[model samples]
Target: MSVFAGRYDGRCAIITGGASGLGKLVAARIVAEGGKVVLWDLNPEALAAAKDEVGATRTYALDVSDPAAVAAAAKDSADALGKVDILICSAGITGATVPVQEFPIDSWQRVIDINLNGLFYCNREVVPYLLANGYGRIVNVSSVAGKEGNPNASAYSASKAGVIGFTKSLGKELAGKGVIANALTPATFESPILEQLPQSQVDYMRSKIPMGRLGYVEESAAIIGFMASEECSFTTASTFDTSGGRTTY
Candidate 1:
């Protein structure tokens, strides 16, 4: 009954932001599929709670935006999990929302550092492990806003768009090397991040989605799971949109 089909047996997966929300769901799914999971998060308490709930999970408490921390975690993960077969760059922040003219420079930089630069850190460090082992799959979580920039969310939108571009470039570079790099774009999903937004903004976002409802974290996780699986062998530098009809690009 498992759609994972034992494709992940004996493999190791690293998911940044795995302490909560979509990342948490993805990590749980990876374990369900017989893969070992190493969760990287900025919050120590959340990581501890997640490990308690998930059981048998390796966790690293570190900020994704810190390249040194990311690199160290990558080395530790390789040593602990035996070379990552899958890497999901899910660490992101929904920064201060305001019109472009009023957007704070610091906030914009914060979002970019984590969503864009942090993603690069993971790819840089993890890919070597994959390349050395001759195989790997990566799914960077982008957003519907990345495809069509949303009003008042310049920072998040821009950072995610960069992630999409980064994924494509990496996928092509390692195309013949057995490493598959792809990005997933999902419409507003039900998550703790939504709880952080003003209700008005939340309703505004939901209305734009053709589905008329926020996506479930588990649904996004399943799609990402497939992309990380060996069965997803044909796609690279591709964007798999889970936009609920909110995407045209």
Candidate 2:
């Protein structure tokens, strides 16, 4: 048996932003560990692709920022897979790289909507199910920018900082309730999200890392997997950093 063998056997999990990047990686790992997964995403094409890869029987197309949609998705997940044992909120946007004063209101709002509000919606919907089952694990994907805001991406920084605060409060509320919440901060990761950004912004991000390279998606997924498993029992309301030595983590 592997080190994580039998760890998530028979457990049910929900992975938002599950269609790509770190979310997709982590979802695959959870399924490989004998757990059931409900993949929630907004992109039909991406969702369909993931469905084909992970099986259509386990995916749902929905926006994480929509509370009613998220609640319904959770119900669908629970009804089909039994109950939610773990949930990973990994959907987010880096938004436009600019000073806050110069940032477009719409752009800044978009980041907050998905990165912070989406997290709130998912947790809001899942908490009841976890409370009912008396067990759950929640992992929110944050960023090193959250710990120390960057110069040109105030929206991304602010949104991620909100995630850190939200996770900590949720963790406190779920204390001793067999439900835990934590955030993961990854800096300059070599993930698909970077594909959407400009070279200059990417260069700026890469320059901040003490390790002198972008972190791998697989490495981030591994840490997320541990936090989702029963092995992460002692940590909650905490920020797990994977910044390649940037921001002191």
Instruction: Return the top candidate by lDDT.
Output: 1
Which ranges in model 2 have alpha carbons more than 4 Å from their true place? 1-3
User: What overall lDDT goes with each candidate model?
Assistant: 0.88, 0.86
Clashing pairs in 1: none
Clash number by candidate, in order: 0, 0
Candidate 1: stretches off by over 4 Å: 1-5
lDDT of 1 by residue, 1-249 (tens): 235646678889899998999888888777877888999998899999998776535899998888898999999988998777889989999888799999999999999999999999999999999999899999999998888888899999999999999999999999989999999999998888886677887888899988799888877888998899888899999999887889857
Ten contiguous residues minimizing lDDT sum, candidate 2: 1-10
TM-score of 1: 0.97
Task: Choose the strongest candidate by TM-score.
Answer: 1
Prediction 1 global C-alpha lDDT = 0.88
